[model samples]
Target: MDNENNVNKYSKEEQLNESRVNHDDQKLTTNQGVGVSHTDDSLKAGNRGPTLMEDFHFREKMTHFDHERIPERVVHARGFGAHGHFQPYESMAELTKAKFLQDPSIKTPVFVRFSTVVGSKGSADTVRDVRGFATKFYTEDGNYDLVANNIPVFFIQDAIKFPDIVHSIKPEPHNDMPQASAAHDTFWDFVVNTPEITHMIMWLLSDRAIPRSYRMMEGFGVNTFRFVNGEGKGRFVKFHWKPLLGVHSLVWDEAQKLAGKDPDYHRRDLWDAISKGDYPEYELGIQIIEEEDEFNFDFDVLDPTKIWPEEIVPVKPIGKMTLDRNVDNFFAETEQVAFHPANVVPGIDFTNDPLLQGRLFSYLDTQLIRLGGPNFHEIPINRPLAPIHNNQREGYHRMTIDQGVTSYSPNSLRGNAPHPTPDTEHGYAHYTEKVDGKKVRERSESFNDHYSQASLFWNSMSNAEKEHIIEAFHFEVGAVMDKQIKERVVEMFNHVDGELATEIAKGIGVAPPQNPGGTGVTASSPAVSQENTNQVAATRKVAILLEDGFNHHQVTQVMEALKSAGVHSEIISKNLGMLTGVDGQQLEVNKNYVNTGSIMYDAVYIPGGRQSVDNLLQQGDALHFVNEAFKHGKTIGATNEGVDLLVISQVEGIELAALDSQAELVSKMGIVTIRNAGDMGTIEQEGYFSQQFVSAIAQHRHWKRKNKKEMVPA
Candidate 1:
């Protein structure tokens, strides 16, 4: 009992180490712990003939390697995870009796997994799909998994239609073409047929589909849940995870380019952020409604396809979660960790939302087959901080060692141990709500109005955001071979907005709908727009474009200023190694032209030197780097002779700084440049070049460029 208490309060890191195996200084051996002599060559007849079948070492090695992999998840197969802790602002004893929510001093250890829904395990990280943000909190009561997604709504209202939507989004069966993308014929066909999926389809076509980084996206539990208090009263609630950094996304061109240049863009961003101590943080918010007021809204409170507008029911942020540690091993921890919506503690219970009810049963059933057994909860990543005990035991992969002869409960032979507790104790109690409904399998009548909220989503998008949505629809529906499917899609979205349907019809070669109904509800939720999010320069990566004989004096000042502001800068050149500046000072090149591209970075910067800029003018890759960054709405900065490259790149969106050949600084539309930088700390002075450049980088991207329709060669 003393030893148990010593490790009882173990954090997730300490608990995970109990199952972690270190092979650092150990000798190589077989699975049975037998020392091996050589593994390079297999046993054969006379060293060159057929291998001997009786060779136990060769057979065993080949057999294990062949069967090493288990089944991947049906959805959200490609994922990355990190370890973190959740801290509440204050006790929420009045709202709910949840132990973790009632304590402000205690930090609950957690594991968070981020993923793409349509892709396989081998898919790219920057795909245009829903991103899963599942979190498992190892609290004192038990493991509570808040399964969520980057988007606040879902594609289907009923659970039975889940399999159908997934099948349609997957590659067509006849020819398994278009890996890890939903821009295909079958997907569009399903969207037009499933009228209930209008709201989700609008989101899937918006900028939210392509995220800039996992650290800068919002997460939402896409189902209505119940929060039960100590007095047996229940309140309807929805979970939200608002990122501290802000909700940001990549342009379609940048996203597609990154798929080829850097497939692990989001995963690498998250890993580098934590490794450099720039931890990602998010706040836990809940939108709650009293049980009596549930039926007072225009839309159904239990509908999975609808979102309770922040104006109607404001989100009350009660806690914050910070991710500070990366997983030690990907497969052992991230892959093996199983999350279920059913893993809830006391005071957090389920509701009668049909989609939520179906997930409770589906998640548990899928884990058994995908994880190979029912004992997956024992895996280190999924194990809870609280102790577990039960009477029935001994399933596949069971690790517990039971000494007693008795396995059943309520028996005098084993002193009738492991007694149950009522609601007064720590035992879990399900919320008791009066229910009277027919045995019909039909959906609720209130869940039938789907186009109204879909129109609300369209009405809330910015002009630029609306353009992106129309472009996305053109790309997704124009790929369809069937003319009927493409036309059906155009007509279906006409209910959302007139211009949206007309623009999509023009691009896809279909007739526009005449009378497009724009759901006359003049309400827009500002919370759903990314234009209204927190922005900062911290953790942003910028590529400093340079060549030999660059201006060290000016570049050093910019670098120092950026570093102080928590911005990461990497030197990109034609080749690797040291680059000598005009003043004999050398700068190390972290990335080369062939190894990196503009899509992987947030901004591009160039320092000034006459000879260096002249040399860079000769390289085609350097010119393309500037144009590509400009086309993607990224910030671009240059000083002195470096502005010459910008002019040669033919990007016309910002005013240059100059006065009759005299040195002057200019800042316009996220582009900062100077005719010349004179001395040390000159750019660092207040209201100077460095300040303007860093502030532009903090803007994340220059989305409001003047040349919004200009085409670049790159």
Candidate 2:
């Protein structure tokens, strides 16, 4: 193969670098690369009449700007992307012949796009909606795209109903009042009418919809696919991407506040984490079942609205993917990069899953319109790392310059060049499964049982999680003005759990169902609960509430401890400048109360200093910050004189350290307090105090504090 066709000779980054332009010291030019001498004024009559068409430079500039915007994606429009690489833990040649998963020594370049499903390009990031987690792997065989979602189950079963579901959940066409929210009448009406959406509604109302970070959520292939091994053995498979950081979510209230305060909160978090070298990592997992055992499950393996309980079929970790580089250009890369489920390699194959079948067509069709034309694959970000020798010719925005005269096959003049690779040579061959089904538009009976997994998900939730779900239902369902729709929602969910329906009824002003139906499946999957996830202090952010006259030694000790634990601490004061400590030590402030609030941080901390606390006690913003953090169940820490600030705030129930005590610590309900300023200075000598506080931060939130949260007023 020539150098141009031999992509393996250069790394993916190197191939992309061929197109990257510095533009720092270069002269301005038109699209044809012709130099432009004058651009400020168009060639016109007397410099003010109608612009002349002969002003080629001005016309080119205007034409490019006018056509700069493409049609935004119908769904998953609000997205962020990053460049990374995937490496397998060990060889998986026994299961599949996928080159990326068959060798631990190779790193396949990958691009991942994280997005919200039901929003426009300008919607808020913290909206309560299913998130899109799509990855494009540039492998030796070809580009393998793993199109997934944060939630395992989808709202609809058949692809034919996709349009209906999307239309119903989107804002009503007439008013379009609510932006990026499901709390409306049309959505509830659709839910009550579609019983198949019962299970997905349960997940949508759960905390999973409002993830704390893309780095902290799990991505599921959703559709059941097939894995074909080297010997032509095929197995049904479901792919999973598990974050190394435990799955976490923002409290509903916090998520709402963040939507208003910072619409780009998630985008900023990802960019900042990567810039700070805190690369996000997720392990790739696959749940495989023998093709013969497909009929053994209670629910259809091909149903998109069901889950193969991890308790039944455990997820096996296969590889890991780390997103270490952010995209240099949002529009050129993240927006233009297209992902299709049909973009598969030799090992990965598709199932007869109805949703998956529709996606195979819908994704490609949409990309053709969303992007300019059929040549979108030639876009640098979407190009593959394998050799390209197809006879495909020009289309809109075609970048390739073919040299052959015989574009057709079986031609003798060009010796039939660019011949197809046979199955023996690793060419993709579809699994040869017997198919004798009817042409009628119908679904299998095995996909009928939808409430069993929904019930299982509800039963698996901890008490705190259950409460959050109930509240979420209240907010979402209660927004409906039509009482019939609200009543139908309660009746529909009654099948999942009688108590859940009753709780939802109480909040939505509906009478409890006299004969609440319940699914007989009493089992639970522990893996579905976020409470069981691993918690670590690493990558957590803390707000250090400091002011003029702060304790230098105490602040230094706590900050150093946080650094050692891989936690990020930001010094926030009344102003964004150097703050003077009690002993004349100066500390730089990263943020100020005017620009930031407790909603931005995972926890709050205040160091010892009589003057600092005195000043904070008088500032309404500082007190509100503490009160709001406590109200949201975030960990709160105060040392010595700083303890007085906690006592004076709206926080209650937890006993704080007494002022006169010497080096005493009081840790309760995620609040850590040290009574002695001297003991805080001894943090390096006796690290127990800081360790306890760090452990509290690792818990993410102290839900026990919810009992008294209603009493606090921020």
Candidate 3:
């Protein structure tokens, strides 16, 4: 199914396609719709002479081309987006009157953009950095934008520090040496000085930073919001988007290699998935607490740097979003679509979180400049489904021409048109949360306990996860030229965990801390760990290694099982073309050893054939591919003479099935091997060896296996 679009009668698609222009079979024309001929050459005095000044066509064409580009976002410049619809599981009329949440039957059209925070428009997609997961919903009330990030918490508690943090993480401005990276002196210096960044830095260093794909990571609002009921009551709420596919990440080694192998890796993954009808799905969840219980938590709910742990305020699944369509044009829809946190509908209001409050002003101001004035909301991608009113007039790029004689309120000529709807009606009414605080440049004392939550995050990680965090710290902090900054960072993180700091210090050649203490908050928030998320093999990509003269029946049997198990498999060989097996079965090779690497797949399989196995053993490219997959802790499987290739590959101390008489199938660790199997099961139900391989892949990665002794060059 190329598109499952027929399953949904989505209104958003109707609106978007209304403006779509297909130039097929159409005559070329100028901007004024005047037909043109001979556009190949400019209107010139002669064949090789200067252009004529009276040629209006050339002037119009060149002028438009000159102004084609717009300013990319200062942050989140490189982005990929998709069209989707959101529908709630059930109505939440009691808690909030937001129409989108009040009906399970309605599908609200949405545009979601996934991006990297620090990189420029041309940066690699797989860089180790924070990802932005902002969604714009064309709801009936208005376009509500949920500007979010992959990390649940943020680097700073207040919005004033956003500039400082972004400036620090970006490459040192003087030299601009390291592009799309935070491995520099400025970032480390910022971290050591701002203790409020403690918790978020831990998250930044975790595997979460290097998501396997946009379809496989979690997103958070990173701010406290309000859910106002129709009865004029409110509750504190935090938003979350949990991917249906389990949270997964590429190892640092794979991520670094992928940057060179494919800078558009994540973007291509999303586009391909949707194009193939394997639409990415995410469930919208909300963590709500009563307005009266705001003071019940140890940390301030308004602090952007603190997370309301799921165990404490459980995430109630409210709705699901599915991205079923790719954009027709990237620049028109994805790039120009403006998103602002303040673009909320009725029954939804903002909290007093300093970050949220400042963003309300900053996001609008940014669009004014980037999209060229206040008319950005008039853009097709940013327009709302709801009707537009008010006396506001447009400025630059204004498309609307007012048809009214009187544009001001209380004008007799226009009969006082577009009268304001009151709270009794459907008009938006801001929540009446009383506020009285002294004007001072200070953070609340409640936001002071940053180390506690940072400690909570460290303790919650699995051993392998913790090791990755330590390694990330070593890589990031060690790159700092100033030894003093590196040492200060280690000492600062000593507050999160002494062992974590010690391990990082050892790797970076920094001095061990004189005193280290695990922040007194030792309680682990298990829900924060990726190890605790869902696990499945659905939609996983597997590379099937094959060559001419391979066992056709065995290959068919294994592939059928993988297909039935919802795994995507591709045939790879030394060259791209057709490969014929001994039994005359032919397979088309889509990718070759030189083009595709082991880092691109979730698992690998090899079917036995004397000619194929013999040829593969002699090729360094083929051998390195298998060894790299094993070193990355991915599942490996082979059958009959294929087992000989694994043995010959000689991946150091790693174990493989022997050739001697034994059971037909042998499962050693994550590697499944079979030999001398006379009776093969039906394709529907594969043999034990194939089943074992599939099961191993379901576990994502074999983290427990120690590959230090069996390391292979990747």
Candidate 4:
């Protein structure tokens, strides 16, 4: 069933819409709604004289403007949010009594914020860093928050070490030189000292750190929580959000170039997608372990730096969320929204996960300062649809005006108003988890094995992913000025995998470990590899290159096929305007070479035309576009005379149909070429070619071409 049909059923979106104000045809007014006759000059004693303090309007306006800015979040500062609704595919009543999960007919209104953990408010979005994937579900019971991250693991196992890791990964305080990067001496030094972080470091260096788009990445709750049923039976659970588009990532080169070319690349992609009705969708999956089976695993269930292999405990998808609406005002909604991990409704409870226990307090504490007050929840985006009634009174920016003769409970004056709720009435009840432990600052013994999973992660990687991880280590560790720290990093990783450490040492100028021994964990989890992710051409963007005298029939035929396959195409040429084909067919260009580049698209296509090919061959920009795209392993398509341009572009190591061939279609190394395409008389024949092109794009990247990519000049 289509999720788009349920967009208007969300009460949260309708509530937010009520707060939206239009400035068109409205008179200027002050905070107290006093209509002002003048506001520009402020009430002055004379035209050039000193202004008087008696001008109340001037004082109020200036005061509001001066205090308009609030403190930005310390981490996850760069965030983008969208509104959506979630619906369960089937009732999960057997697992949890959470009202939102128990009902299949109810659509829970949700607001999701995607962010980068280490970046400042103004930092670029494409930085290689952990991304925050926090979601707030406004249910009938209350607001249930699922605060998560793009990576399933974290750097430190305990939350108390959060500040230290943040300090080391952030720009060095002395110079603050490397903005939004972990490539420095401090981070490597921390890595060498903190052995438990080895598993997370492996993930950080992988392609998952740099997602192709926010819509394509995965989300994990990171810490374990509890799912309590109506019978009070509890199970350990971990949350996951799997994007329907599949997991994809950008190459290091593309990410670096796009950071400078467009700092807001991720947010722009999300905004544009929703505006065009190409809403992002994710299925909510849970990995659950019965209370009795918790100790059956070798690793501690409470450790935050570990993942339960999907093969062992498969992910059961419970519901789906569709982000069908964009925020009307970024500041009022995306900026002001608050999320706390402790925001649980009935049937959801916490575990003894130390990292999660620490976050329970930290998230709320940070929001108090960042959002200016505890009353931040009163903000339209954060306010829940459930009725809120309590004895608690006013604070800074409190929107509610409580009325009663008595504000305290247990008084005859008001007959005990705002009484507590029982379990039968859906009141939140903490699971009765037996606890018998001493209060001490010590970690459990079960949390000590850090290298086993790290080795498993290394073993699970496909050859292409392994190569990317090694190159990532080269860039990150190679930036460390301290040679001792670099050598120590190599040694620390030796425990995870001998070959991985040796390869890391090769790039960072460190000697290979003297005793390069792995954890001897040979088992691999195929689910962790991006090579096994879903592949589809839907929502993929393709850039169509054309100039005057392009083949209109070929362009029209291929574009129709792409559209039918749910692909978006844009005409990119030397200049913006109408281009006349050889057959006198005109088409408008969406972007010009000066304003856009090859990095902005997923793939490239060139339609055949004698004049267009001749003109493109002369322009260095056009050849560079083709070469650069090929270097990045993106799909490239050429039809008829378009094949001549690819040949001149010097994308070698692949066989292409010769210019004289008879309707030959040569598909090799993710490059599709057709010779004598004008000879095709039917759309069916053209569709076969288009189908091959789209299928190539679906593979995301042709890693087999990486070995030959270095030969390209661009």
Candidate 5:
């Protein structure tokens, strides 16, 4: 019943360990051929003496260890990847001639890398930044890379400003004060100067940036691209990946705490979910706009800082992808796998989006230095399932040997082999869109309207979401030592919304900007709000606290009911092992007070028993467990003596319905307590209690409930 035992039941860790095949597995001996004993340890002179120069073992280990680390990505250095397959829901022959899209039965192998854009490899995962959700699909024709992010918008419109934005967000050169954080003077100054980043800044400050789990958030190809059909017809398209579990996020405080509690929070969530058969699923959705109707929308399609609102051009769910396997080796598979937007099939093509254009160069350029050569594609994880044939050869780390002396085209000796195939043969043909412009460093006038979409995002958020955004802005801006930078940020964001600027100003102790500007755009997209997302209790963790002499039968029944609804329940007691029930039943303990905290789980449950209640009351930490759960707006259920803890804790206006009294205690309120067994039975049987609990959990916190007691309970 311990975490180790529960983890062993899944065997995911064992499978991961087995997947990592060391060089010793091939039975290859050392150059000396004197069968080696200790591969993990280097040979020492004598009892941890200076490493001997003649020690081949020590030399080999040090040589390999020295080269263990590859160059971290210039951007998105911290990343985690998984293996999956994509299956189209139906054929889309009319839209595109791509074989992968044309065949509904074909399952395309995919490797997806979820990354933090600004952090280094060793940085924390729960930072306020955009998450890179890049997917590489190995189709029959070639690999199609859908390089994307959790946010639909980018920080800038043109690729030229990419380096500038990146430099601003990165740690300052003078002292490198902040690591993996944008809440600094440089970042604010850049934002205030470049208003185009307003929309993405709004998203970065929202809870969406700090996702509860990578499996539960949405991904978007931030730039527009074109889809070419067999007939040469083209349509501008934007890709989206909608998670099956819907979008969920952690409270800012919780996210920060989790960074310390578990730096691998997102990675562990993904591995654990897949290992337990809860495969992460995402549906491939596309927003298609006809070539002729491209100019029909009010916003510019090529602007990377804007979104084609789903309300205007609805996303057509085309395919589904499920990540069923974890990586074999972090360095060989996850780290070596290269993704570039330039990797496209016959049907897929790029647009004139400048940011996308720059990424096309950046991805390939970074791989050459990071992976040590142009032959990175030969890496097992990056290899295309389809056959490869070409005259190009002889790069660093070349693993393949060309048979003949014909490494170039136009050679009769090679029978003109590997010749270029026509477009009809499913060859990659670029879209033939006419373009005529003088070479100049300038932005399109159409891309000038930056504040419109930013305002639209502000208008779309729910009240609770707005509050969180304001708090986020306050926390970030308040961290800046420069007061002028904070004032400038408030003034600049005033264009997005007056209320937003005012709220942020109030929290940061700055004067609200007078007469905040507006873009006169009244558009709003409801899909941007998390409150409208699908809510479920499936896979949500609920902690059940119990002690000796507890009402085991009632607790067991409640736990079973939760499990039947797909809720994960963990029993936590003061000690590990087993606790005896009132009826002499032994209940397994999943966690002890010393090992777990209230922040680890989604909700808390307490069972009614005289001895258990008395024991819990005596333990100060146990009382804190209830208070913290309540502070988080999690549901609390108690029948008999369990209710006593709530009373002793002095919860304000604590109301309990008398057994069989038939009286309601403030309908649809923050807290609920049932006295009668029959009422509890009705609540459980009808699933009303479960629904209420799930709703409370989704709300995340009840800001309405104010704690009145002055004395701090210790």
Candidate 6:
């Protein structure tokens, strides 16, 4: 096994370096390879004269710059991508004949792009929208793209309504006001009219919409696909990618704050994690059912707005994917890599889901315009490892050279070579499902139960999760200036959960909605909630705000422990320069108060020292940092004089411990303190404090402590 693994690794390395040899010793030159002294300026009559047209350098440079940008994606414009490998945990020969899944030893190279659905290319990361989790596998068969999303369900039932749904959620046409947000009149108005979107609206309004990090979020294909075995037997399957770190989210306030504090939070987290060898891992799980049993469920299996409950069909883990490499260039790789749901291998096939069917056309059409013509597949990043042979050739940016008399299929020309392969012999064959129905524009009755699963999702959430959902609804509805739209939306959601609608209405200072009714389906799936997800402290960032005369020894002890535990800790002060510690040790500050804020970090730590506390009090932003951290329910540690700052600021709900006492204060409330810097030895052993902090960070907010009053300065 070791020898085989080494051989495969060597082959991959060789392939990666295959295109690098040409540039090894090449000198800098233009496209013509003419060595020029200067490339920055064009040949002119004089220094301040008009540039001459004879200077091809300037013409070429300006021409390239003029056409540098292509059309951005109509949806999911903001995205981050990484390189990775997909390895099956065991042979899935029983389910499919796809080579990538049939071999446990082979590591198929993959490129994944994570994106936001509605935001443009320049929008902020933390927004209330479905995240696009698309992966392209360069398998020996071809490029297989598992285009998915963070949510399992989509807004529209059919592809025909996709454009309408997108248009409604996008900025209002009259005035593009609200970029990267759905909290507006048009969105709610659409929701009120479109009943099929209720289930997805529940997901969009939940904490799942505001993921803490890309590494911690779950991914779902959102559409049912088919798996065919060698014998032509097929089964319906839904794909799921469960993150090892588990699903987590930020508080609405925290997300809003981070948008300003760190707009590149998710992208930076992914890049930093991969660079540090803390590669993000996700398990590929599939919910499979017999093709004949598709009608056995209460809802239409082909409906994109519905989900298969885990209780009915368990998710079978098939493989694991680790994103271990960051892209070399954002434009060349991340921006140009195209992912289409229709890119399937022989073993995998598509279903007749309206949205999925539309996506099959949309993705290819989008690439043609975005990547320039039909040759996007020829791009290095989108190219497959296997050889591509076809009579279809030539387009804008064509990279391949076909040297044969035959450019078209069929006939005795070229001895009828490059012929099509039969399905029985390693060829893709569509499943022979009988289809005989009258052509009509209508939806299936099974797709009508939009409120049941939405209610199930509501019922599955934990208390904290439910509170966050209510807060999200309040936030979104509060932003709607139209009173009728807000009322209509609340009334529409009342059918999902009367309690939720009433609570949101109260929070937003609106009248409680009248009960429109429910689906009367008393079922809850615990898997739908993030509270039951796996939790770990790995890759969580803790900001240690320090100033001159800080407790160097205590700070170093805590920082070392956190670092050893895989928690990233950075010292933030009022300046980027070094500050003298209490013991005269100079500690380097990574960020200053002007650049960094508590919202950008997972937790906050304030080391004790008289001068440090004085400096914190003197800086207004530093005091607001502590106040904001406290309000957000982040885990905060302050020993000795560090506690003095908290007290001086009169931060609400803080229970400080007496100096010299090791008794932990607010042990179960997410706040931790050792009272003295010398008592740092027991910090890790304080399991109670650890549990509290972890739970607090996981909850992401303490909405119950809603004190409208501002903090008082002592």
Q: In candidate 2, which residue ranges exceed 4 Å CA deviation?
A: 1-70, 677-687
Give lDDT for model 2: 0.86
Candidate 3 matches the true fold with a TM-score of 0.89
* lDDT by residue for model 2 (1-714), tens: 687766564543443354255767788787899987654333433311223446566445544432323698878989999999999999998899888899898999999999999888999999999999999999999899999999999998766466667778888765575888899877888899888889999899999999999989999999999999899999999999999989999999999999989999998999999998889999999999998898898888888899999999999999999999999999999999999999999999988787776677668777877787899999999999898998889889999999969888988888888887999888999988765543333456677887898999999999999999999999999988778788898899999999999999999999989987789779999999999998988899999998888899888888888888888999998888899999999999999987889999999998888899899999999999999999988999998888899988988999888667567778899999987656453234444568788889999899998889898986
**Clash pairs for candidate 1:** none
**Which of candidates 3 and 4 is the stronger one according to TM-score?**
4
Given candidate 2, what's the lDDT at residue 434? 65
lDDT ranking, high to low: 4, 2, 1, 3, 6, 5
Q: Model 1, range 596-677, lDDT digits (tens) per residue? A: 9988888899889988899999999999998889888889999888999988886775677763587777888878888857
**lDDT digits (tens) for residues 132-207 of candidate 3:** 9999999988889999999999988655456668778887765675888989877888889889989999999899
Task: List the RMSD of every prediction in angstroms.
Answer: 16.3, 16.0, 16.2, 16.1, 15.1, 17.2
Query: Candidate 1 lDDT (Cα, whole model)?
Result: 0.84
Please report the TM-score between candidate 6 and the true structure: 0.86
Candidate 3 lDDT score at position 453: 91
Better of 3 and 4 by lDDT: 4
**Number of backbone collisions per candidate:** 0, 0, 0, 0, 0, 0
lDDT of 3: 0.83
Q: TM-score, each model?
A: 0.89, 0.89, 0.89, 0.89, 0.86, 0.86
Clashing pairs in 2: none
Off by over 4 Å in 3: 1-70, 650-654, 661-663, 678-687, 707-710
For 253-276, candidate 6 gives per-residue lDDT tens digits of: 878878887889899989999999
What do the candidate models score in CA lDDT, each in turn?
A: 0.84, 0.86, 0.83, 0.87, 0.77, 0.79
